[model samples]
Target: MKKLLVITVFLVAASAFLFGATYRIGLSLSTLNNPFFVTLRDGALQAAAGLGVEVIVADGRDNPAKQLGDIEDFVQQKLDLIVINPTDSDAIVTAVEEANKAGIPVITVDRGASGGMVIAHIASDNVAGGMMAGEYVAMLLGGKGNVVELEGIVGTSAARDRGEGFGAAISKYPDIKIVAKQVANFNRAEGLVVMENILQANPNIDAVFAHNDEMALGAIEAIKAAGLLDKIKVVGFDAIDDAVAAVNAGEMAATVAQQPFLMGQLAVVKAFEYLTIGTIYIPVDLQLVTSK
Candidate 1:
């Protein structure tokens, strides 16, 4: 009877620790398929584990409705907080509001919503990265060239800021013209097909500015297959491993490296701080990350 009583006491203590110890946070990613986001997710996972927080993974899959649903579920579950990689800025407003209504903080990563204030917004300087891409290509072509630009998903801040910044940078060199521009939706397959067509149609193209490295690598493949490997220069954003290798091999010119892991880690760190301090740490001015 004595042994039984001790074991029962131990089991009750273990159960209490398990339930009481968890600091649950809900996570919503823009898309689980993107390598950039995968790195970000890894950082969030690591940070949450280190902080003894439970992260409930939710896949947005680049769908605003899906992301909203996931956030609603989190609100219903009464999770501690939320980390959102918004699919669309406008569409994410209500979802962030939902978190706010539940008294749960929302930390945005990679993308920010247009409304419903969040605890923190974690992202790289996408606009500056685009400027770097444009300058690198212009330098490669001696400030005069016909360039084809590969864009990411339209409407999102990443694509819009990158395109606008790159356009502004390239406009400084009047001789450099964007012969063609197309949205590849940030997918490798779309990039390959679109770039192939662009190459066939624009045989006089001098370079390419891909908004992200995946599309840039895809464009490189198409350029090689079309027999324009050495004739065309390619600049991309996000110094992913393959892009770095290509840069070293002379297949790609340069990439604006964004520390995606750091972005995610900061988001998680801020989320925890919001829980404890009820505030965030987003800087008052621009935080830019540019260069290889």
Candidate 2:
């Protein structure tokens, strides 16, 4: 009887030791406070939880240094995987390199890390989204007009790609010139203030292209406040609910929509595959999804 009891106890202990260990995945985000990114977090968490993988989240809150610190923490914890939404691309190189050295797969979600290679990049085609915004605005203005560009966080891929795409598209229409452009840091408040000033100088501005919905909404508010609502057609990227509502209401022209939830889902799914299958993707630009 004693021997049988001991065998049962050993079996239980071994099972606990094997199955109770959680596989931790590091999640580093640009801003936990932002609603769009909040959806990303929720989706990521849900996916990870469904797979019984532990997720360690690090909030950068729009700071590069904080993101680096969070990455370091994940490395120290020896996490199975690391997911990053870099605050700025250039600032995250060292930390991403560290994760690679530690044999942990690094997945870049939405905003990419600057000057570093990662296991996978999961995001909408920001360049295409930008070009879409530009084309939409040009068509809205009947292919020729003076427009102002409300840019996102400078130097990030989204900002650079979107701006470049928009610029390239607008160049096709020689008469459609960008009247003024400056970084609004992807913040609505900054967008409003910047557009308010631009309104003062370029009252005859025919359109406005904001790199993201937050900035576009702000620009719309500023345009209305300055009594130029009907005069300027506004186009923005990232179809946040507010932006879509504005589009439906005819308050703003249109927005290039990015699937934030899908970005999160893909990142989680890819991270799981890399950990389990040891797969390496062929070099191809994997654009997740972006739309109207």
Candidate 3:
């Protein structure tokens, strides 16, 4: 009787050890300064709570080297899964490879890594979103106008894909000319400065398309300061709250909305799924938000 009792207790302990184990996931975001990324982080936290998993979030702060260091820390900690929103597509490959060498699967959210064995990628179709913005801008200008383009960070996949799509769409209309193109690094302050310079250099600007809402908002400020807000239409991507408000107030023409919260939620959920059974790539939806 004593032996049987001991065996029963041991079995219960073993079962608990095997079944009650909690998973730890690491999420490295490019930057939390942007409202869009903040929403993404919140969504990831919410999903982690529901799943009863531990999530260690690291803010890259828009620095590639810092982000790489964060990934190395996660690898050393032996986390089950690592999710990255890369600051630079090409620069993040080394970090992703390091995680892979540690036998820790890596997943990417929003932007992609140029070369890495990412288990799965979760993001919206940025190229399609950019094309949508371009088509809308062309329609607003009756297929003929002088346009300015405010680009995002040069090495980011979001910037490259969006620019490709926008250029492809604009190429269809021969009357529409891109007079000035400048890099704002997806920053509002830089957007204002770049737009101000473009405005000064080119007086016949009819429309502007910015890779992100932050930059678009900046351009709007410059245009407003120059007292040309009514004359020039502005379009932006990421459909952040401020950009949406601008659209509703007739201060901006349109914006392509990507679900950052949903992207974050799925990144966590998918990481958990891959750790358990298996998972596949996920592409979130995008919408063109305009006053109409």
**Maximum-lDDT candidate:** 3
Model 1 lowest lDDT segment of ten: 1-10
Candidate no. 2 TM-score: 0.87
Q: In order, how many clashes per candidate?
A: 0, 1, 0
TM-score of 1: 0.86
Per-model C-alpha lDDT, please? 0.82, 0.82, 0.89
RMSD per prediction, one decimal?
Answer: 9.8, 9.8, 10.0
TM-scores for all predictions: 0.86, 0.87, 0.89
Ranking of all predicted structures according to lDDT, beginning with the best and ending with the worst:
3, 2, 1
Candidate 3: give the clashing pairs.
Answer: none
Weakest lDDT window of 10 consecutive positions for candidate 2? 1-10
For model 2, residues 1-292, the per-residue Cα lDDT tens digits are 2353234334433443465644689999998766689889888887676566788888998888888889899999999999999888887888888888888778898988776669789888888888888888889889888999999887688898899999999999988989999899989999999999998887889999998889999999999998888888999887888999999999999988877876776677567656654563233334678795
